[model samples]
Target: MKALTIEPLTRDAFAPFGDVIELQGARQIPINLGTTIRYHDLARIDVTDAGGRAIVNLFRGQPRVLPFEVTMLERHPLGSQAFIPLTDKPYLVVVAAAGELDPEAVRAFVTRGWQGVNYAKGVWHHPLIALDDVSDFIVVDRGGEGHNCDEQALPESLWLTSEGLRGAAG
Candidate 1:
């Protein structure tokens, strides 16, 4: 039987694919929790108020990925996206350009996020990967009327196993 080998996920190497938003050192800026913070005098406001609802899709059942097949797939065209791996060990994050999802390029990434994870806009990738375990997360995206989402399952099953990565690395 064939096997797949996993590798480490890096930021600089992944920049060409998309933004690797691994919060290495971002501390919480306390600004009085109860009061609404308004800013009209600031020179530049970096935050855009996109009034949207945060949706949390809980999966009580175990997360399973078939051999050479995708477990969870999702596409977002509007706001930026994120995939926070719930496990402490390394997981997989396969991303590609919009309308440019190649299986070869997708197979190259096997990074991990320890704290939290978030990806920038227009980055195409699988929804969430729990690596060796199942994970649950709150998906924050533009939840409005209109269809700006597309999810495609590959015709052939593609498994990311330990042997597979070692073969590719060689």
Candidate 2:
């Protein structure tokens, strides 16, 4: 199995697939009598295509351990999908380009508990890869019309391991 090295999630690195949602380097706005700081426009929510509407979902994911098999990847063709970690623990994201699933194009990223990602329309990605234990995510995506979810198998096997996490930027 080809092993994936987990890289630190950065806006520039992930721009090809989607936006990196985080508080750092975001436009801040003061609201509600200046009691709240808003991190504005962190991501573009593009769920309104083909009579679709934006929707919020709570995705509770079970944890995965190392040497994780990379068998399949999925994508949303109709709109973008965002996963914001509700649990203050690190997680993994595996993604590829927008078109066909190239096993060689697959990349892995590790979030710093506070960061999130918005997968652009049709970008191939693995489902949530929560670590250690059960985790929760606030998912924002399209809710109506057309087949948004598509899953495909990998050409070959790939594995993500603990060593990858250790190599990521802390």
Candidate 3:
């Protein structure tokens, strides 16, 4: 059995692996919406497209807490889009790739990397599993319009707990 680790989500920390989309602090910017108001850089956001055509949908809803047995699915030729965690204490389930096609030595690794949005596309990963409540996510993907979407399940099960992430600090 493999123990799951909770990692803190930070821009600098997650930069090595993928784009970290979260507001580090407030930066005032002029509002151009036919009104005069200051806009803050609430979160660092990035957008992805395919052949100048976007295939993603943005939906707003409360964040969903995941179970310990959360398993990841795999995809290829497409990138991933995720939401940045905003709660004071947020947790995420990160899984590494496994199989002969996986060039990495590790097999199905899981740990917490960032509290904000982090995703791996053209890479192997699990489905949506939230760490807190009321998380607003800006989804990025190749748009589920075609048949290129591929998902493969893992044999070994994994788990996540709040106690595990208590000591992680960004």
Candidate 4:
């Protein structure tokens, strides 16, 4: 199996796959008597074309150890999906561009607790990978009629390592 070195998540690095949901470099608006700072339009919720509705749900994901094996990836052809962590725990994100699975084109990223991601429609990505204990996340995705999800097994399994990601920006 091949190995994928995890890199720190950043908006620029992740732009090809999706949007990185974070307060850093985000548009901020002070509201509610100046008691709260709202990050406006952090991610684009794209479910309009699927004839589906956007739904928010809480996902409690169990942590995974390092050197994890990635055998499969999935994508939503009709809509996009976003995952926002509810706790201060890191997570891993594996992604590839839309189209046939290309092992060499795959990229891995490690995200901080404060960061989230919105996978664009047709972008291939792994399922939620929570780290450092059970983590809760706010997942926003399409819910309703058509089958929006498409999954594919990789040509070969890939191993992902948490190495070289310490203190990296997320």
Question: Which portions of model 3 miss their true places by more than 4 Å?
Answer: 25-52, 59-67, 84-93, 97-120, 132-134, 144-146
In model 4, the clashing pairs are: none
**Candidates 2 and 4, the one with greater lDDT:** 2
- Models 1 onward score TM values of 0.59, 0.97, 0.60, 0.93
Error of 1 at 68 (Å): 4.5
lDDT of 1 by residue, 96-132 (tens): 5566555444443665545333444455677555554
For residues 1-170, write the lDDT of model 4, one tens digit per residue: 58887888999999998899999999999999999998899998898774788999999999988778999999998888999998888899999998777878999899877899999988999999887799999999999888888889888899876553553454
Ranking by lDDT: 2, 4, 1, 3
Best lDDT goes to which candidate? 2
Cα lDDT, model 2, residue 156: 91
The whole-model lDDT of each prediction reads 0.49, 0.93, 0.47, 0.88
The global Cα lDDT (0 to 1) of model 4 is 0.88
lDDT of 2 by residue, 84-140 (tens): 988788899999999877889899999889899999999999999999989999999
Candidate RMSDs in order = 6.8, 0.9, 5.4, 1.8
Summarize candidate 3's per-residue lDDT along 41-64 as a digit string, tens digits.
443323243432344455444544
* Candidate 1 regions with alpha-carbon error over 4 angstroms: 1-7, 23-61, 65-68, 71-73, 85-87, 113-116, 165-170
